[model samples]
Target: MSSTTRTTCQSECLCDCNRPGAACQDPRFVGGGDGITFYFHGKKGQDFCIVSDSNLRINARFIGKRNQNMKRDFTWVQSLGILFDTHNLFIGAKNTSIWEDSNDRLSLGFNGEPIHLLDGEGTKWESMTSPSVTITRLLDTNSVEVEVEGNFKIKATVVPITEKDSRVHNYGITQEDCFSHLDLSFKFYALSGQVNGVLGQTYASNYVSKVKMGVVMPVLGGEKEFSSSSLFGTDCAVARFSGQFTEGNSLENLEYGNLNCSSGMNGRGVVCKR
Candidate 1:
């Protein structure tokens, strides 16, 4: 058994929730590649697109509880479904009634097959199929990094909403469940200017944030535009995925050796040349 901690975007990567292109507590997102933070309160038990580009798609399933005092549910990202070049990857936090720091609660699957990694920090697994992908454990348990060469890197950590959180935010967390969720940070290597989704749109060259800035907590509204029928669906109104791979596609043509990378506040690092 691995014990759980309260993972925050700030602790995981170079770019965190306070910076840009990260998603954290209660579903706050920092996007626009300009550090504009906003809240996207997609309905509980629903799936929403976080990134939808021509060659890549990422969706999140939200889980939450309702408070009679509030008009909407208090939600958190429960899992991530990633689709790329005909492959599907799933990462999620397994539901637990009690959290222990030494107990592992992370669940992962690649192409519909369960992924089991040896319990140890720095343990890694790489895909055996085409289009190389890898997952590395950043800690002994509950924290890992998923990376697809020439595509994207995602850091996901499983966390729980503590009783202190419930008391402070009135989350009403009960003994039955602590509402484990994910704290995530992303780094995209070759996103197109036409990319669209909650976080993907901010990477577009012509993106203009719809969030109302300068507020303590800005909320982004567009549930219908970002909603998907399922965790792996790419049918959001603003989706740009074609769901088809052809010869000479960007994934096949990307120069793996010529990439120029630089550290930035937007993501893990900026790929100057892709």
Candidate 2:
């Protein structure tokens, strides 16, 4: 069974890592509804649930390097696996030895098939299946917007660790791999009050944070609760997914040419105006 709801395009609906309800560099997360910031350092090479609603489930795969001086690994979100209804979408950054902004490192897959788009801004791909999904390139390379109609929209940008970052953070990054990763922003239209996950809990009406405030680096520790078996798994302890399609599953007829997209401040994300 399928459900439908009407949704509009609004600016405030966008949620970037710099804003509330985002997970960005080093896996730092800003609350969904609350204005709290915290870090979740799940084990390296592990997958964890970031968002789990009644109909939508999103998991992130962490990639990291063990710092010789630090106790824990320094992790970043390397890829995302999104499950809605019976479809699966995968977005990831391919590892590269030499970082080049001119080359595309963003990798995309739907269901089990690879997705390829043209090399230009405004290039897009639309799924022919029900619960329409659209992926649009916001830049000439390595930046895209994945929208599931009224359900949600995710803006993903592929990035690499710079030499300065490695030097300052003591990442011990080598020339073998640049460790390409993603910086993501999200916008969700219809989410249930029962939503739960690393970022989803903040959307609950009765949610209360347990994170310590006024600290140098407030961290949210729930590795067991948010751990998933795989990138596409919805078996996390706080998972609320039912593997069913909910309301607002229709496709929007957006004019790609009308989209005005620009890099956010500090080149953090892509902001689009319709």
Candidate 3:
């Protein structure tokens, strides 16, 4: 039996659900992009809930260390926890579960527990190349159109790992450290035109997760001309947008598919009607 629930650490105050911190003020980020509202009861079968009120419906974004330098750049975001009902696990496991990173090197294993994304600047791995992160679809409006080609860069920062505050594990019970301590904010870009050795970029990181409908797209890295591709089974719903669109810029056209990148967001590259 395990339990956790937290929000109260004020220092920079934003409270957005993608895990960016001033620590504590988790009213679920009130209403800025109109995305933040949570309620979980669990135990029906085991664990499964991904917020409802503010309507996070379903979201995911992960793009790791492109070049590293955004407060030790090593990206993170995994708000997942909604399988409709399969007993959906993690942090509330039922079958096989255990995911540990504690700070920022990142690990993996899940049927449950994968809602982490840290860049709190603790730098230790000393990159040769491990910071090229991607996991998208969280831009509630403020201009957005990300197809990308070359020469583009965008950043928004915040970092703070963990520090434990209240606990009584080992069965005694009483676990209050919902998120030991965390702070991560992201928005990055790079991709304009005149491509050369293969360069492209895309940005969207404020974090949001619910992923788990078909389950199969998480291997990352293939072909390598700078690659990553995703579009969901199609219903108009969107996710996976990290790029390189040259050779006449792909997304088709509608004014380049309304390319705007911020202020209501926009990016057009549709082709998922299997």
CA lDDT, every model vs. true structure? 0.77, 0.75, 0.20
RMSD of each: 6.4, 9.6, 17.7
Model 1, span 152-248: residue lDDT tens: 8888888888877777788888878889888887877777767789888877768887876555556888889999999999888988887543223
- Candidate 3, 1-274: lDDT as tens digits: 1222122222222222232111111111111111222211111111111121111111222212222232322222222221111222111111212213221222221233453333333222211222322222112211111111122111111222222221221111122312221222212122122211100111112323221223222111112222112111111113122222223332221111111111210111111111
Who wins the lDDT comparison? 1
lDDT of 3 at 216: 23
- Per-residue error (Å), model 2, residue 118: 1.2
Kindly list the per-residue Cα lDDT of model 2 for residues 1-274, writing each as its tens digit.
0111111112222325555555777877767656566778888899999999878899999999998888888898999999987889999999887786678899999999999888998898999875479999887888889998767888888877776667777888787877778877776777777778998887776789878765556688999999999999988999889876444532222112233334432213333223
**Which residue pairs clash within candidate 2?**
5-248, 21-31
Specify the poorest-scoring 10-residue window by lDDT in model 1.
Answer: 265-274
Better of 1 and 2 by lDDT: 1
Global fold similarity of model 1 (TM-score): 0.85
